[model samples]
Target: MVDERTRYFRRLRRLRNSARRWSVMGGGLAAAAAVLTPYAGIGLADAAWAAAAGASVALAGWRWRDHKALAALPAPPPPDPALAGQRLVAAVERFPAGRTVVHELRRQRTRYALRGSAVAQAWDRLDRAAGTLSALAGRLTGPGEAAVLEAAVAERWLRDLGQRVASVERAIPLSPVDQRPVLASSHDSLAGQFTEGVTAYERLVAAAAGYVAEDGQPVVDERHPTLTRLIEATDRMRGIAEGLSELRRHPAV
Candidate 1:
């Protein structure tokens, strides 16, 4: 299937072609009209030609306007292994994700970080995952087909899961004596899920790294070895953290 980027560039090429045709047709018509204008009222042909001269000039100018737009819309590189790796790594490097997340946590946001807690452990796991992604970014852009596409997705899931885990961890310590037992259960649930999510994240990364390097063709999404399962597992952990935090705020009587 043609991806959106392919369709988009196709459209631009079509427009560029159209503009070239109009410029040729319009310039010829305008020249004819100019020659005809000298003989206006001499015959019906000259009058009609002069009357439509501006239309031709306008068509010729279409090329100039469209050229600016075409210049602005540069086509993406053709699909290849290097481009694939570049895109995935760029996503990993972008806002609130990957190595950026690791740097932000260490350099700026360490104040709220609870040492040796589930959140802390999750962060450490994320650090390792980021390292794996960094290697993949440099070495394994793609084969942009199948489960390989989900590599960035898995990292994002782990990142989001970390946010939710942090939220729940913060709320856990502040619970009242009566709610400690229930809150502790919720915290343990988060810890378990985080461990599971990170484990799967690493395994999935391992498969992807090996596959592109020398392993073999990866399975498609339905049978993708690890991504879907990791996504679902990470999603569930996020829900647990979010729900636990909400319950702490409005405890049931």
Candidate 2:
């Protein structure tokens, strides 16, 4: 999986690199053509070649923008197999599992020195909550009435979360490195979208908390599923938010 992710990043980097080079080359040629056309005589062949060159330049610029948008996105971290496997186990485990829940609580309590204050904290809580939800989701074995209901709710939440994560991921490519005004506007817009996603996840979490309080049970029920979905959504939002925090911490080249 790590190998696959690395390969993906490598391919994207190569594509962006190629696009940047092409944009520069095309723009240069376009400028050169404009300069030469006046003095070189307006022959039919010259006009045709110039038109082709102009089109190429336009295409290059389009590619450049496309690639740049991708490059600007926050790079996702390589997955930890050990961690993933551990989380999988935790997900199947009963709620309030000492081993799983405590670990996450500690991480949240620490308050790591990261930027994007609200976004960062929100994500940490979401991650911690997700681990327990994973366990609950897994424990709902068989297609019993409760099981089916929980699964449906959990699945819906998961799907919504996936969409929110994708939105933030797409926005990452819009980051601006230079030009303060343009960068600020772009950064705020992208960051705002991310924040909204986070907020949506939080509402879900709150709903989950309400459910657990009403039942006083560790196992997830139909109501629990809605909460579970929100918790999971929070988890993904946190992951993406964490990425944004890191991006802000370390300026891009």
Best by lDDT: 1
Worst 10 residues of 2 by lDDT: 110-119
Q: Each candidate: what lDDT?
A: 0.69, 0.60
Candidate 1's residue-wise lDDT over 63-125, tens digit each?
Answer: 667766876876776677677776766677776658666566453454245465567766676
RMSD of 1: 26.1
- Candidate 2 local lDDT, 130-161, one digit each (tens): 54455454444443336436545654564345
TM-score of 1: 0.39
Which prediction has the highest TM-score against the true structure?
1
TM-score, predicted candidate 2 vs. hidden true structure = 0.28
Candidate 2 Cα outliers beyond 4 Å, as residue runs = 1-4, 38-41, 81-253
How do the predictions measure up, each by TM-score? Answer: 0.39, 0.28
